[model samples]
Target: DAVYNILIDRWTKSSTPIHCIAHSLNPWYYSKEWINDVSGRVSPHKDMELSEERNKCLRRYFPDVKERRLVNQEFDRFSGGLDAFGSFDSLEDRWVLDPKAWWLVHGSSAPILQNLALKLLGQPCSSSCCERNWSTYSFIHSMRRNKISPKRAEDLVFLHTNLRLLSRNDADYKQRESKLWDIGGDAFDSFDNGAGVLEIASLSHDEPTMETMLFTDDED
Candidate 1:
């Protein structure tokens, strides 16, 4: 409870109206008061009113007059009844559906909010996946085979990563491979004929060295 209070205090201090608006769109958090405590730290109704005010401020800069009108109409619909915007009868069911997909399919009445939800919800909060991809790139473009052209290296990396992702399911893997072959039959044939040996050599050297294993604490 002490840690939660500290965290919430920091979060509330740093938070903007945009953050509040995003939280309001999320079904799970929609019913939650701005501050979920009995103590008078924040007023939930006042916070909601502020969020709506911020939303209005955000809408003022719309360059397109037609879009502005559409947004206002959507807001009217949303204010009238939250349930009127989506097909789902219950918020519980909406919680199970992908938030972006739900907004895209069901937010026709609230186009501006839908677009905002899609943008906000789809944002990546961390660069961990990008860092991992860079690690993979280092393995693919090792010091020895650094002669590989940037374009060819990119294509190889794309194929390698996507093929690995598809490998879990045999049928899907084969289907994707067949589709790739159909699209770039000549390129694949050329790669097989010319770069097969070079690729194998690259993969051989790409294996983790003893030092790498020691640093990573990997026994195998």
Candidate 2:
């Protein structure tokens, strides 16, 4: 119970109105089995916090009062499973397809809400991916390389990030014989040198010898 309470508190702090809106738009939340599977969790319509946040998001996105009202009316139909949303195909497809794809299929009836749902549902729920990009930025713009101009640093980071992304799709990235893949390490540029042999070789000239560093101990 304590662990659950901590997790719930953390989630509440991290969650935004967009998260609530995404939850409200997802069809699985309306499922009886899904609701029952998670204690204290309810459909968006029945969840006061979720409904409030959903309304807040709606107002922010659809600032026009009349347009917001239209979206809300459409939301009612969606939540109630009325009209096109209630069709056997859509109801069955709720579990069969991804949320964004499901919206793409049956969302023509509520075009406004559909567009909002597609955008919100497609977003990443966390900043981990962005943090990774920042990690690469830090590596490129390190203290040792502080003399590099911001524009040059930005360009290098962009080039490095895109290259890493493109390289992942190459066949050699996964081939053991190619030795191009980086299983794990502190260094991020290992992919350029097979098994990082070239990196180790380069570091030997500029930095302390690996053997001496490993064997030496500091007395504090």
Candidate 3:
């Protein structure tokens, strides 16, 4: 309790309590056990309050009977048996595994909670990616492209980002390559060579280069 208070005091002084709680909700770094411990020590009603807040948040998004029932069903599954998810005997292994993937596989019985967990756990702790995405949007919807409709611009950005993400995944890349090959042999060969070069370049350095050092200095 003393340690918890100390940490909470430090965090509160440096940042908002809500931000700290949100950060703690991230399952990749902290699990339910951690939440229970912190909340238990922080305040007797902390857990209940947090649960109520989460319920309210969900309700705001989904107020219909069907969605509410789904949420209730998910809660029932969770409360009925932790074993419903899987054996938590290997805590270290579970921690190392992606929380999103784990929830998808194990929480299939609780679809609503599975979806909720994925959404929460997948949230980045920082806004850097969002800022970069805005930069992408600006580049895509530049002065010359100002005439583009909002819907068209949105579609273009979505396709550009998602395609780049898909290309990073090996299975998706292979599938895309196969489709490209069917379209044209020369094009496929050119794509394969370019991809190979990029892969080699990405793997070329384990240590920081002079350029990286300069970038770090600039950031500092």
Candidate 4:
């Protein structure tokens, strides 16, 4: 978040509402890194998982990311040990991460850190507004595996993200909808309603529910 504030202080200029809003929704650093009294220390290197020092310089290959710092050696080493070197232990890394899978989704970064940065990134404190509906978001992914055609997978995820994964119910829809309006006004507001059509919505306080009309042109 500190980095977000620093960057926003210099890069972002608009204050008329649209460009002024931030939208960051991910884990933080201190929280995840502070496990079992470790207090932000890297996971203990058991020396048992040191398959080998084979992945020592994966970061050197990172294109835009500079040689910021060293990495942990004991963590999982799937993608050529990409994570074995990052310092998700720091708040700065959470605020401005690149296009890597684990960092945004998993990694050690905490929610508080990313939440703070989301404020500075001018985005929102949400991951809900990120998607659309549920039923239409059909994909064949499983924790057991994720193998599918790139094209169909893209469409499924696209549907999943814009229609389902982001917000599948009501209260979330409203909250995210408001944030969208803050960023892009009616344009974005009309695009995502958890339902295809725009209309009045309501839900119970406990659940993320909303009532909207579903359509089927074939019925005509």
TM-scores for all predictions = 0.45, 0.68, 0.44, 0.20
Candidate 4, number of clashes: 22
lDDT of 1 by residue, 163-212 (tens): 76565345542344553232124454443454233332333334335225
1 or 3, greater by TM-score:
1
Model 4 C-alpha RMSD to native? 19.1
Question: Which of 1 and 4 is ahead in lDDT?
Answer: 1
Total clashes for model 2: 0
The C-alpha RMSD in Å for every predicted model, in order, reads: 13.0, 11.9, 11.7, 19.1
Two-way lDDT contest, 2 vs 3, winner? 2
Arrange candidates, best TM-score first: 2, 1, 3, 4
* Model 2 C-alpha lDDT per residue in residues 150-197, reported as the tens digit of each score: 899889988987886677568776545533333224443433554344
Consecutive 10-residue window with the lowest summed lDDT within model 3: 198-207
| Local distance difference test values of all predictions, in order | 0.56, 0.76, 0.54, 0.35
Candidate 2 local Cα displacement, residue 43, angstroms: 0.9
Clash-forming residue pairs, model 1: none
Clashes of 3: 0
- lDDT per residue for candidate 3 within 12-113, as digits (tens), equals 574543433333333444445544555445321235655565556557657897988887666554543345534573243345667666666566777766
